[model samples]
Target: MPVITSRDHPLVKQLIKLEGSAQYRKKTGLTLLDGINLIQIYCSILGKPENLIVSESYYEDADNKHFIDIIFGHKPPKITIISNSLFRAISPVKTPIGILALISIPALKEQAYSRKVVFSVLLEAIQDPGNLGSILRSAAAAGVNNIYLSKHCTDAWSPKTLRAGMGAHFFLHIHENSDLKHIAQQFKGTVIATSIQASKNLFEISLVGPTAFIFGNEGAGLSKEMIQAADENIVIPMPGKTESLNAAAAAAICFFEKVRQERDSILSSNIGTK
Candidate 1:
Protein backbone atom coordinates (compact mmCIF):
# COMPACT_ATOMS: atom_id res chain seq x y z
CA MET A 1 0.00 0.00 0.00
CA PRO A 2 2.92 2.37 0.76
CA VAL A 3 5.59 3.59 -1.69
CA ILE A 4 9.28 2.91 -1.18
CA THR A 5 11.20 6.00 -2.37
CA SER A 6 14.49 5.50 -0.60
CA ARG A 7 17.23 3.60 -2.36
CA ASP A 8 18.16 2.10 0.99
CA HIS A 9 14.81 0.36 1.53
CA PRO A 10 15.21 -3.31 2.46
CA LEU A 11 13.11 -4.47 -0.46
CA VAL A 12 15.13 -2.34 -2.87
CA LYS A 13 18.30 -3.84 -1.50
CA GLN A 14 16.88 -7.32 -2.05
CA LEU A 15 16.20 -6.46 -5.69
CA ILE A 16 19.70 -5.05 -6.04
CA LYS A 17 21.06 -8.29 -4.67
CA LEU A 18 18.96 -10.32 -7.12
CA GLU A 19 20.06 -8.22 -10.11
CA GLY A 20 23.76 -8.70 -9.46
CA SER A 21 23.93 -12.16 -7.99
CA ALA A 22 22.68 -15.27 -9.75
CA GLN A 23 23.39 -17.27 -6.63
CA TYR A 24 21.00 -15.09 -4.69
CA ARG A 25 18.28 -15.73 -7.24
CA LYS A 26 18.85 -19.46 -6.98
CA LYS A 27 19.00 -19.41 -3.20
CA THR A 28 15.86 -17.33 -2.87
CA GLY A 29 14.02 -19.52 -5.41
CA LEU A 30 12.85 -16.27 -7.03
CA THR A 31 13.91 -14.35 -10.12
CA LEU A 32 13.09 -10.93 -11.54
CA LEU A 33 10.50 -10.32 -14.26
CA ASP A 34 11.21 -7.07 -16.12
CA GLY A 35 8.34 -6.43 -18.54
CA ILE A 36 4.70 -5.99 -17.62
CA ASN A 37 3.58 -8.57 -20.20
CA LEU A 38 5.86 -11.20 -18.70
CA ILE A 39 4.76 -10.40 -15.18
CA GLN A 40 1.12 -10.61 -16.22
CA ILE A 41 1.68 -13.96 -17.92
CA TYR A 42 3.61 -15.33 -14.95
CA CYS A 43 0.85 -14.34 -12.62
CA SER A 44 -1.79 -15.98 -14.82
CA ILE A 45 0.09 -19.26 -14.75
CA LEU A 46 1.71 -19.20 -11.30
CA GLY A 47 -0.67 -17.12 -9.19
CA LYS A 48 0.04 -14.01 -7.11
CA PRO A 49 3.55 -12.74 -6.75
CA GLU A 50 5.06 -12.16 -3.31
CA ASN A 51 5.92 -8.59 -4.32
CA LEU A 52 5.73 -6.19 -7.26
CA ILE A 53 8.04 -3.31 -8.16
CA VAL A 54 6.14 -0.48 -9.81
CA SER A 55 7.42 2.79 -11.21
CA GLU A 56 6.10 5.91 -9.53
CA SER A 57 5.31 7.36 -12.95
CA TYR A 58 2.90 4.66 -14.16
CA TYR A 59 1.36 3.61 -10.89
CA GLU A 60 -1.94 5.27 -11.79
CA ASP A 61 -2.25 4.13 -15.41
CA ALA A 62 -5.91 3.35 -16.22
CA ASP A 63 -5.29 0.01 -17.94
CA ASN A 64 -2.82 -1.00 -15.28
CA LYS A 65 -5.33 0.10 -12.66
CA HIS A 66 -7.99 -2.16 -14.19
CA PHE A 67 -5.55 -5.03 -14.43
CA ILE A 68 -4.55 -4.58 -10.80
CA ASP A 69 -8.19 -4.48 -9.71
CA ILE A 70 -8.98 -7.74 -11.47
CA ILE A 71 -5.84 -9.63 -10.43
CA PHE A 72 -4.97 -8.05 -7.11
CA GLY A 73 -7.92 -6.07 -5.80
CA HIS A 74 -8.75 -8.22 -2.81
CA LYS A 75 -5.25 -9.08 -1.64
CA PRO A 76 -2.62 -7.56 -3.87
CA PRO A 77 1.01 -8.52 -3.73
CA LYS A 78 3.17 -6.12 -1.76
CA ILE A 79 3.47 -3.22 -4.21
CA THR A 80 6.71 -1.32 -3.79
CA ILE A 81 6.51 1.83 -5.87
CA ILE A 82 9.97 3.30 -6.31
CA SER A 83 11.30 6.55 -7.77
CA ASN A 84 12.52 6.52 -11.39
CA SER A 85 16.15 6.72 -10.23
CA LEU A 86 15.90 3.81 -7.80
CA PHE A 87 13.74 1.73 -10.15
CA ARG A 88 16.53 2.04 -12.74
CA ALA A 89 18.99 0.67 -10.20
CA ILE A 90 17.03 -2.56 -9.71
CA SER A 91 15.94 -3.21 -13.29
CA PRO A 92 18.22 -5.23 -15.60
CA VAL A 93 17.26 -3.36 -18.78
CA LYS A 94 17.95 0.26 -19.79
CA THR A 95 14.30 1.34 -19.95
CA PRO A 96 12.49 -0.04 -16.95
CA ILE A 97 9.05 -1.47 -17.80
CA GLY A 98 7.50 0.29 -14.75
CA ILE A 99 6.40 -3.18 -13.65
CA LEU A 100 8.51 -6.05 -12.37
CA ALA A 101 7.63 -8.98 -10.18
CA LEU A 102 9.44 -11.59 -8.18
CA ILE A 103 8.44 -15.01 -9.50
CA SER A 104 9.21 -18.46 -8.18
CA ILE A 105 11.09 -20.86 -10.40
CA PRO A 106 8.73 -23.18 -12.24
CA ALA A 107 8.91 -26.88 -11.41
CA LEU A 108 10.17 -29.11 -14.18
CA LYS A 109 7.71 -31.53 -15.74
CA GLU A 110 8.31 -35.27 -15.55
CA GLN A 111 9.83 -36.69 -18.71
CA ALA A 112 7.46 -38.72 -20.91
CA TYR A 113 7.55 -40.71 -24.18
CA SER A 114 3.95 -41.41 -25.30
CA ARG A 115 3.45 -38.64 -27.88
CA LYS A 116 3.60 -39.90 -31.49
CA VAL A 117 5.45 -36.76 -32.61
CA VAL A 118 7.61 -35.03 -30.00
CA PHE A 119 10.38 -32.48 -30.51
CA SER A 120 12.66 -31.51 -27.65
CA VAL A 121 15.34 -28.78 -27.83
CA LEU A 122 18.77 -29.55 -26.44
CA LEU A 123 20.90 -26.48 -25.67
CA GLU A 124 24.40 -27.84 -25.11
CA ALA A 125 26.48 -25.40 -23.08
CA ILE A 126 24.85 -22.29 -24.53
CA GLN A 127 26.36 -19.43 -22.55
CA ASP A 128 24.29 -16.46 -23.70
CA PRO A 129 20.94 -16.02 -22.05
CA GLY A 130 19.41 -14.05 -24.92
CA ASN A 131 20.33 -16.63 -27.54
CA LEU A 132 19.03 -19.47 -25.46
CA GLY A 133 15.81 -17.61 -24.82
CA SER A 134 15.32 -16.84 -28.50
CA ILE A 135 15.88 -20.48 -29.33
CA LEU A 136 13.31 -21.50 -26.76
CA ARG A 137 10.84 -19.01 -28.26
CA SER A 138 11.47 -20.43 -31.71
CA ALA A 139 11.19 -24.00 -30.46
CA ALA A 140 7.80 -23.30 -28.91
CA ALA A 141 6.60 -21.48 -32.02
CA ALA A 142 7.72 -24.34 -34.27
CA GLY A 143 5.54 -26.77 -32.31
CA VAL A 144 8.22 -28.42 -30.19
CA ASN A 145 6.32 -29.90 -27.29
CA ASN A 146 9.24 -30.14 -24.90
CA ILE A 147 12.67 -28.69 -24.16
CA TYR A 148 15.66 -30.38 -22.53
CA LEU A 149 18.41 -28.14 -21.18
CA SER A 150 21.80 -29.61 -20.41
CA LYS A 151 23.27 -28.79 -17.03
CA HIS A 152 25.73 -26.54 -18.84
CA CYS A 153 23.00 -24.42 -20.47
CA THR A 154 21.98 -20.97 -19.29
CA ASP A 155 19.43 -20.44 -16.54
CA ALA A 156 15.99 -20.67 -18.07
CA TRP A 157 14.46 -18.27 -15.53
CA SER A 158 17.07 -15.51 -15.62
CA PRO A 159 15.64 -12.05 -16.28
CA LYS A 160 17.21 -11.50 -19.68
CA THR A 161 16.19 -14.95 -20.89
CA LEU A 162 12.62 -14.66 -19.62
CA ARG A 163 12.17 -11.39 -21.52
CA ALA A 164 13.58 -12.82 -24.73
CA GLY A 165 11.39 -15.90 -24.46
CA MET A 166 8.30 -13.66 -24.33
CA GLY A 167 6.52 -16.06 -21.99
CA ALA A 168 7.23 -19.26 -23.95
CA HIS A 169 7.98 -21.05 -20.68
CA PHE A 170 4.31 -21.51 -19.86
CA PHE A 171 3.45 -23.22 -23.15
CA LEU A 172 6.16 -25.88 -23.21
CA HIS A 173 7.54 -28.67 -21.02
CA ILE A 174 11.14 -28.09 -19.92
CA HIS A 175 13.56 -30.62 -18.48
CA GLU A 176 16.90 -29.71 -16.98
CA ASN A 177 19.91 -31.94 -16.24
CA SER A 178 18.71 -34.33 -18.91
CA ASP A 179 20.47 -37.28 -20.52
CA LEU A 180 20.12 -36.96 -24.32
CA LYS A 181 20.79 -40.60 -25.12
CA HIS A 182 18.26 -41.90 -22.66
CA ILE A 183 15.74 -39.23 -23.74
CA ALA A 184 16.21 -40.23 -27.37
CA GLN A 185 15.72 -43.88 -26.59
CA GLN A 186 12.65 -43.18 -24.47
CA PHE A 187 11.04 -41.04 -27.18
CA LYS A 188 11.89 -43.62 -29.86
CA GLY A 189 12.67 -40.77 -32.31
CA THR A 190 15.69 -40.09 -34.44
CA VAL A 191 18.16 -38.55 -32.02
CA ILE A 192 19.47 -35.96 -34.48
CA ALA A 193 22.37 -33.68 -33.55
CA THR A 194 23.24 -30.55 -35.53
CA SER A 195 26.81 -30.07 -36.67
CA ILE A 196 28.66 -28.26 -39.45
CA GLN A 197 30.94 -31.10 -40.38
CA ALA A 198 28.22 -33.70 -40.77
CA SER A 199 27.82 -35.17 -44.26
CA LYS A 200 24.04 -35.44 -44.08
CA ASN A 201 22.05 -32.33 -44.90
CA LEU A 202 19.07 -31.64 -42.65
CA PHE A 203 16.67 -31.43 -45.60
CA GLU A 204 17.56 -34.94 -46.74
CA ILE A 205 17.08 -36.43 -43.29
CA SER A 206 13.77 -38.18 -42.72
CA LEU A 207 12.54 -36.23 -39.65
CA VAL A 208 9.26 -38.08 -39.31
CA GLY A 209 7.44 -39.50 -36.29
CA PRO A 210 9.14 -38.53 -33.05
CA THR A 211 12.38 -36.52 -33.35
CA ALA A 212 14.68 -34.74 -30.90
CA PHE A 213 16.82 -31.95 -32.37
CA ILE A 214 20.05 -31.22 -30.50
CA PHE A 215 21.38 -27.66 -30.79
CA GLY A 216 24.83 -27.12 -29.39
CA ASN A 217 26.73 -24.21 -27.87
CA GLU A 218 27.35 -21.00 -29.81
CA GLY A 219 31.13 -21.24 -29.77
CA ALA A 220 32.32 -24.84 -29.41
CA GLY A 221 29.22 -26.47 -30.87
CA LEU A 222 28.12 -29.84 -29.54
CA SER A 223 30.38 -31.52 -27.04
CA LYS A 224 32.07 -34.63 -28.42
CA GLU A 225 30.44 -36.62 -25.68
CA MET A 226 26.96 -35.49 -26.76
CA ILE A 227 27.79 -36.04 -30.43
CA GLN A 228 28.94 -39.56 -29.74
CA ALA A 229 25.71 -40.17 -27.88
CA ALA A 230 23.44 -39.08 -30.73
CA ASP A 231 21.85 -41.61 -33.13
CA GLU A 232 22.12 -39.29 -36.17
CA ASN A 233 24.06 -36.09 -36.82
CA ILE A 234 23.07 -33.70 -39.62
CA VAL A 235 23.97 -30.24 -40.93
CA ILE A 236 21.88 -27.45 -42.45
CA PRO A 237 23.01 -26.41 -45.93
CA MET A 238 24.80 -23.06 -46.15
CA PRO A 239 25.15 -21.18 -49.42
CA GLY A 240 26.91 -18.09 -48.14
CA LYS A 241 30.63 -17.53 -47.66
CA THR A 242 29.83 -17.01 -44.02
CA GLU A 243 31.32 -19.84 -42.05
CA SER A 244 28.07 -21.03 -40.51
CA LEU A 245 24.77 -19.94 -38.99
CA ASN A 246 24.39 -18.81 -35.43
CA ALA A 247 23.04 -21.40 -33.03
CA ALA A 248 19.57 -19.84 -32.79
CA ALA A 249 19.34 -19.47 -36.57
CA ALA A 250 20.45 -23.03 -37.09
CA ALA A 251 17.86 -24.22 -34.61
CA ALA A 252 15.04 -22.31 -36.30
CA ILE A 253 15.95 -23.90 -39.63
CA CYS A 254 16.11 -27.42 -38.31
CA PHE A 255 12.92 -27.10 -36.31
CA PHE A 256 10.89 -25.66 -39.18
CA GLU A 257 12.22 -28.30 -41.54
CA LYS A 258 10.74 -30.92 -39.27
CA VAL A 259 7.50 -28.92 -39.21
CA ARG A 260 7.46 -28.74 -43.00
CA GLN A 261 8.01 -32.46 -43.36
CA GLU A 262 5.25 -33.25 -40.89
CA ARG A 263 2.81 -30.96 -42.70
CA ASP A 264 3.57 -32.63 -46.02
CA SER A 265 3.09 -36.05 -44.48
CA ILE A 266 -0.38 -35.08 -43.20
CA LEU A 267 -1.38 -33.62 -46.56
CA SER A 268 -0.34 -36.82 -48.34
CA SER A 269 -2.33 -38.90 -45.89
CA ASN A 270 -5.44 -36.79 -46.46
CA ILE A 271 -5.05 -37.05 -50.26
CA GLY A 272 -4.75 -40.87 -50.11
CA THR A 273 -7.81 -41.16 -47.87
CA LYS A 274 -9.84 -39.02 -50.26
Candidate 2:
Protein backbone atom coordinates (compact mmCIF):
# COMPACT_ATOMS: atom_id res chain seq x y z
CA MET A 1 0.00 0.00 0.00
CA PRO A 2 1.29 3.44 -0.89
CA VAL A 3 1.34 6.20 1.78
CA ILE A 4 0.23 9.75 1.05
CA THR A 5 1.54 12.60 3.22
CA SER A 6 0.84 15.70 1.12
CA ARG A 7 -2.50 17.51 0.79
CA ASP A 8 -1.54 18.27 -2.81
CA HIS A 9 -1.50 14.60 -3.85
CA PRO A 10 -3.67 13.90 -6.91
CA LEU A 11 -5.99 11.57 -4.99
CA VAL A 12 -6.30 13.99 -2.10
CA LYS A 13 -7.20 16.83 -4.46
CA GLN A 14 -9.79 14.65 -6.16
CA LEU A 15 -11.32 13.68 -2.81
CA ILE A 16 -11.54 17.35 -1.80
CA LYS A 17 -13.26 18.25 -5.05
CA LEU A 18 -15.70 15.35 -4.68
CA GLU A 19 -16.46 16.22 -1.07
CA GLY A 20 -17.25 19.85 -1.88
CA SER A 21 -18.90 19.71 -5.28
CA ALA A 22 -21.83 17.50 -6.30
CA GLN A 23 -21.04 18.56 -9.87
CA TYR A 24 -17.58 16.98 -9.59
CA ARG A 25 -19.13 13.74 -8.37
CA LYS A 26 -21.68 13.82 -11.19
CA LYS A 27 -18.96 14.49 -13.74
CA THR A 28 -16.69 11.68 -12.55
CA GLY A 29 -19.54 9.23 -11.73
CA LEU A 30 -17.93 8.65 -8.31
CA THR A 31 -18.98 9.24 -4.73
CA LEU A 32 -17.25 9.08 -1.36
CA LEU A 33 -18.22 6.74 1.45
CA ASP A 34 -16.95 7.66 4.89
CA GLY A 35 -16.67 5.42 7.97
CA ILE A 36 -16.31 1.66 8.29
CA ASN A 37 -20.04 0.91 8.29
CA LEU A 38 -20.79 2.66 4.97
CA ILE A 39 -17.77 1.15 3.24
CA GLN A 40 -18.74 -2.31 4.50
CA ILE A 41 -22.30 -1.94 3.22
CA TYR A 42 -21.10 -0.65 -0.19
CA CYS A 43 -18.67 -3.54 -0.56
CA SER A 44 -21.30 -6.09 0.45
CA ILE A 45 -23.93 -4.76 -1.96
CA LEU A 46 -21.92 -3.48 -4.93
CA GLY A 47 -18.44 -5.10 -4.75
CA LYS A 48 -14.96 -3.67 -4.30
CA PRO A 49 -14.54 0.09 -4.23
CA GLU A 50 -12.22 1.98 -6.56
CA ASN A 51 -9.96 3.15 -3.74
CA LEU A 52 -9.80 2.72 0.02
CA ILE A 53 -8.02 5.51 1.91
CA VAL A 54 -7.12 4.99 5.54
CA SER A 55 -5.36 7.27 7.97
CA GLU A 56 -1.88 6.18 9.15
CA SER A 57 -3.04 6.14 12.79
CA TYR A 58 -6.07 3.95 12.03
CA TYR A 59 -4.03 1.63 9.80
CA GLU A 60 -1.54 1.12 12.62
CA ASP A 61 -4.12 0.67 15.40
CA ALA A 62 -4.26 -2.86 16.81
CA ASP A 63 -8.02 -2.52 17.38
CA ASN A 64 -8.56 -2.01 13.65
CA LYS A 65 -6.44 -5.01 12.66
CA HIS A 66 -9.49 -7.15 11.85
CA PHE A 67 -10.95 -4.50 9.57
CA ILE A 68 -7.59 -3.99 7.88
CA ASP A 69 -7.38 -7.73 7.28
CA ILE A 70 -10.81 -7.67 5.68
CA ILE A 71 -9.75 -4.86 3.35
CA PHE A 72 -6.66 -6.78 2.32
CA GLY A 73 -8.80 -9.87 1.69
CA HIS A 74 -10.39 -7.98 -1.23
CA LYS A 75 -7.23 -7.22 -3.16
CA PRO A 76 -8.58 -5.55 -6.29
CA PRO A 77 -9.07 -2.03 -4.91
CA LYS A 78 -5.71 -0.36 -4.24
CA ILE A 79 -5.43 0.88 -0.64
CA THR A 80 -3.60 4.06 0.29
CA ILE A 81 -2.62 5.09 3.81
CA ILE A 82 -2.64 8.84 4.36
CA SER A 83 -1.27 11.03 7.12
CA ASN A 84 -3.78 11.83 9.91
CA SER A 85 -3.78 15.52 8.96
CA LEU A 86 -4.42 14.79 5.31
CA PHE A 87 -7.22 12.39 6.23
CA ARG A 88 -8.88 15.02 8.41
CA ALA A 89 -8.75 17.52 5.54
CA ILE A 90 -10.58 15.09 3.26
CA SER A 91 -13.16 14.00 5.86
CA PRO A 92 -16.53 15.80 6.11
CA VAL A 93 -17.53 14.60 9.59
CA LYS A 94 -16.81 16.60 12.73
CA THR A 95 -15.14 13.57 14.30
CA PRO A 96 -13.09 11.96 11.54
CA ILE A 97 -13.60 8.20 11.13
CA GLY A 98 -10.13 7.77 9.52
CA ILE A 99 -11.38 5.65 6.63
CA LEU A 100 -13.14 6.49 3.35
CA ALA A 101 -13.83 4.84 0.01
CA LEU A 102 -14.14 6.22 -3.50
CA ILE A 103 -16.70 4.23 -5.41
CA SER A 104 -18.67 4.52 -8.64
CA ILE A 105 -22.28 5.63 -8.30
CA PRO A 106 -24.68 2.77 -8.76
CA ALA A 107 -26.59 3.16 -12.02
CA LEU A 108 -30.38 3.10 -11.99
CA LYS A 109 -31.71 0.49 -14.42
CA GLU A 110 -34.81 0.69 -16.66
CA GLN A 111 -35.98 -2.57 -15.08
CA ALA A 112 -36.28 -0.71 -11.78
CA TYR A 113 -39.07 1.44 -13.25
CA SER A 114 -40.70 -1.53 -14.96
CA ARG A 115 -41.24 -3.46 -11.73
CA LYS A 116 -44.71 -3.57 -10.13
CA VAL A 117 -43.90 -1.45 -7.10
CA VAL A 118 -46.03 -1.98 -4.00
CA PHE A 119 -44.86 1.06 -2.10
CA SER A 120 -42.97 4.11 -3.32
CA VAL A 121 -42.04 7.65 -2.21
CA LEU A 122 -41.90 10.81 -4.29
CA LEU A 123 -40.11 13.86 -2.92
CA GLU A 124 -40.46 17.29 -4.47
CA ALA A 125 -38.11 20.22 -3.75
CA ILE A 126 -36.95 18.81 -0.42
CA GLN A 127 -34.07 21.17 0.25
CA ASP A 128 -32.70 19.62 3.43
CA PRO A 129 -30.28 16.77 2.95
CA GLY A 130 -30.85 15.46 6.48
CA ASN A 131 -34.61 15.29 5.92
CA LEU A 132 -34.21 13.47 2.61
CA GLY A 133 -31.82 10.94 4.15
CA SER A 134 -34.10 10.32 7.12
CA ILE A 135 -37.03 9.74 4.77
CA LEU A 136 -34.98 7.27 2.75
CA ARG A 137 -33.96 5.42 5.93
CA SER A 138 -37.58 5.18 6.98
CA ALA A 139 -38.66 4.17 3.48
CA ALA A 140 -36.17 1.31 3.47
CA ALA A 141 -37.35 0.16 6.88
CA ALA A 142 -40.97 0.22 5.75
CA GLY A 143 -40.15 -1.83 2.61
CA VAL A 144 -40.65 0.89 0.02
CA ASN A 145 -39.79 -0.51 -3.45
CA ASN A 146 -38.72 2.76 -5.05
CA ILE A 147 -38.02 6.44 -4.29
CA TYR A 148 -38.28 9.29 -6.77
CA LEU A 149 -37.01 12.80 -6.21
CA SER A 150 -38.11 15.86 -8.20
CA LYS A 151 -35.51 17.85 -10.07
CA HIS A 152 -35.57 20.63 -7.44
CA CYS A 153 -34.82 18.25 -4.56
CA THR A 154 -31.41 18.19 -2.91
CA ASP A 155 -28.72 15.80 -4.08
CA ALA A 156 -29.44 12.40 -2.53
CA TRP A 157 -25.79 11.29 -2.76
CA SER A 158 -24.38 14.32 -0.96
CA PRO A 159 -22.20 13.56 2.09
CA LYS A 160 -24.75 14.93 4.55
CA THR A 161 -27.59 12.92 2.99
CA LEU A 162 -25.41 9.79 2.84
CA ARG A 163 -24.56 10.11 6.52
CA ALA A 164 -28.20 10.62 7.38
CA GLY A 165 -29.29 7.65 5.24
CA MET A 166 -26.81 5.35 7.06
CA GLY A 167 -26.81 2.15 4.92
CA ALA A 168 -30.34 2.54 3.56
CA HIS A 169 -29.01 3.71 0.18
CA PHE A 170 -27.79 0.22 -0.63
CA PHE A 171 -31.28 -1.22 -0.08
CA LEU A 172 -33.17 1.28 -2.24
CA HIS A 173 -33.82 1.93 -5.95
CA ILE A 174 -33.44 5.70 -5.77
CA HIS A 175 -34.28 7.83 -8.82
CA GLU A 176 -33.28 11.45 -8.42
CA ASN A 177 -34.27 14.50 -10.50
CA SER A 178 -37.45 12.78 -11.60
CA ASP A 179 -40.59 14.22 -13.10
CA LEU A 180 -43.08 13.85 -10.24
CA LYS A 181 -46.07 14.94 -12.31
CA HIS A 182 -45.41 12.39 -15.01
CA ILE A 183 -44.85 9.66 -12.45
CA ALA A 184 -48.11 10.54 -10.70
CA GLN A 185 -50.02 10.61 -13.98
CA GLN A 186 -48.71 7.21 -15.05
CA PHE A 187 -48.83 5.38 -11.70
CA LYS A 188 -51.04 2.30 -11.76
CA GLY A 189 -52.03 2.52 -8.09
CA THR A 190 -53.15 5.15 -5.64
CA VAL A 191 -51.13 8.39 -5.72
CA ILE A 192 -51.47 9.93 -2.26
CA ALA A 193 -50.40 13.38 -1.11
CA THR A 194 -50.14 14.61 2.46
CA SER A 195 -51.73 17.89 3.48
CA ILE A 196 -52.86 19.43 6.77
CA GLN A 197 -56.17 20.58 5.35
CA ALA A 198 -57.33 17.38 3.68
CA SER A 199 -60.63 15.92 4.89
CA LYS A 200 -59.58 12.26 5.02
CA ASN A 201 -57.22 11.07 7.75
CA LEU A 202 -54.15 9.06 6.78
CA PHE A 203 -55.29 6.02 8.78
CA GLU A 204 -58.65 6.06 7.07
CA ILE A 205 -57.11 5.33 3.68
CA SER A 206 -56.52 1.82 2.36
CA LEU A 207 -52.77 1.41 1.74
CA VAL A 208 -52.71 -2.39 1.35
CA GLY A 209 -52.63 -2.05 -2.45
CA PRO A 210 -49.83 -0.48 -4.46
CA THR A 211 -49.32 3.09 -3.15
CA ALA A 212 -47.14 6.08 -3.86
CA PHE A 213 -46.85 8.76 -1.16
CA ILE A 214 -45.76 12.22 -2.23
CA PHE A 215 -44.01 14.54 0.23
CA GLY A 216 -42.83 18.01 -0.57
CA ASN A 217 -40.75 20.99 0.62
CA GLU A 218 -40.49 21.90 4.30
CA GLY A 219 -42.20 25.26 4.13
CA ALA A 220 -44.49 25.12 1.09
CA GLY A 221 -45.71 21.55 1.30
CA LEU A 222 -46.53 19.86 -2.02
CA SER A 223 -46.78 21.82 -5.22
CA LYS A 224 -50.20 22.55 -6.75
CA GLU A 225 -49.33 20.38 -9.72
CA MET A 226 -48.49 17.45 -7.46
CA ILE A 227 -51.62 17.84 -5.35
CA GLN A 228 -53.76 17.98 -8.48
CA ALA A 229 -51.92 14.97 -9.87
CA ALA A 230 -52.61 12.84 -6.79
CA ASP A 231 -55.43 10.32 -6.67
CA GLU A 232 -56.24 11.27 -3.09
CA ASN A 233 -55.15 13.81 -0.50
CA ILE A 234 -54.95 12.80 3.15
CA VAL A 235 -53.97 14.46 6.40
CA ILE A 236 -52.07 12.96 9.38
CA PRO A 237 -54.87 14.17 11.73
CA MET A 238 -52.82 16.05 14.26
CA PRO A 239 -55.15 17.03 17.11
CA GLY A 240 -52.57 19.22 18.78
CA LYS A 241 -51.87 22.87 17.98
CA THR A 242 -48.69 22.10 16.09
CA GLU A 243 -48.76 23.74 12.69
CA SER A 244 -47.11 20.91 10.78
CA LEU A 245 -44.80 17.92 10.97
CA ASN A 246 -41.32 17.96 9.53
CA ALA A 247 -41.11 16.42 6.07
CA ALA A 248 -39.04 13.47 7.34
CA ALA A 249 -41.34 12.79 10.28
CA ALA A 250 -44.40 13.02 8.05
CA ALA A 251 -42.86 10.56 5.58
CA ALA A 252 -42.03 8.05 8.32
CA ILE A 253 -45.58 8.17 9.62
CA CYS A 254 -47.04 7.58 6.16
CA PHE A 255 -44.61 4.77 5.28
CA PHE A 256 -45.02 2.87 8.55
CA GLU A 257 -48.78 3.20 8.36
CA LYS A 258 -48.66 1.57 4.96
CA VAL A 259 -46.45 -1.14 6.45
CA ARG A 260 -48.89 -1.70 9.32
CA GLN A 261 -51.83 -1.98 6.97
CA GLU A 262 -50.08 -4.47 4.68
CA ARG A 263 -48.86 -6.60 7.58
CA ASP A 264 -52.35 -6.78 9.09
CA SER A 265 -53.86 -7.62 5.71
CA ILE A 266 -51.41 -10.52 5.31
CA LEU A 267 -52.28 -11.81 8.77
CA SER A 268 -56.01 -11.62 7.99
CA SER A 269 -55.49 -13.55 4.75
CA ASN A 270 -53.50 -16.25 6.58
CA ILE A 271 -56.26 -16.61 9.20
CA GLY A 272 -58.94 -16.92 6.47
CA THR A 273 -56.85 -19.54 4.68
CA LYS A 274 -56.30 -21.51 7.87
User: Best by TM-score, which number?
Assistant: 2
- TM-score for each candidate, following the candidate numbering: 0.90, 0.93
User: Count of backbone clashes for each model?
Assistant: 0, 0
Off by over 4 Å in 2: 71-76, 112-117
Q: What is the C-alpha lDDT of each candidate?
A: 0.81, 0.86
Clash pairs, model 1 backbone: none
The residue-by-residue lDDT of candidate 2 on 168-202, one tens digit each, is: 88888899889999999988899999976688989
Candidate 1 off by > 4 Å? 70-76, 111-115, 181-187
State in Å the error of residue 231, model 2. Answer: 0.9
Model 2 TM-score, all chains together: 0.93
lDDT (Cα, 0-100) at 233 in candidate 1: 87
For model 2, the run of ten residues with the poorest summed lDDT: 109-118
